[model samples]
Target: MRSDIVPVLELGAYAAHIPYHMTWAHEQLPYTPEHERFLELECISDILEHLL
Candidate 1:
């Protein structure tokens, strides 16, 4: 993933199924406490609908 995904696409994984990967991405990103709280409150589809 580091070689093919990171270098090839140049866009790091935004959302990963593995908890470790999600934690890593969140580390690189700016802290969003509200988003995290929303995720806990809403379904993924509902959250995506709000986003999309």
Candidate 2:
């Protein structure tokens, strides 16, 4: 995992998530902005943790 893959995944997840997860925006959507951002944060954190 180069770490950047997560963004690509999350994007694909967001795009495909609607039909794959069968979710709607108001109906507790599986892909939330906050959650995706959280994953980004986690990815950066993991990178920093590995570097330091």
Q: Which one wins on TM-score?
A: 2
Model 1: per-residue lDDT, tens digit, 1-52? 1222223223432431112334444244343323221232234455565468
Scanning candidate 1 in windows of ten residues, the lowest lDDT window is 1-10
Regions of candidate 1 where Cα sits further than 4 Å from its true position: 1-39
lDDT of 2 by residue, 1-52 (tens): 2333346566765211212334344545243454433333333345454346
* Stretches > 4 Å off in candidate 2: 13-52
Best by lDDT: 2
With candidate 1 superimposed using the best TM-score fit, by how many Å does residue 33's alpha carbon deviate from the native? 6.5
Task: Report the number of backbone clashes for model 2.
Answer: 0
lDDT of 1 at 39: 33
Clashing pairs in 1: none
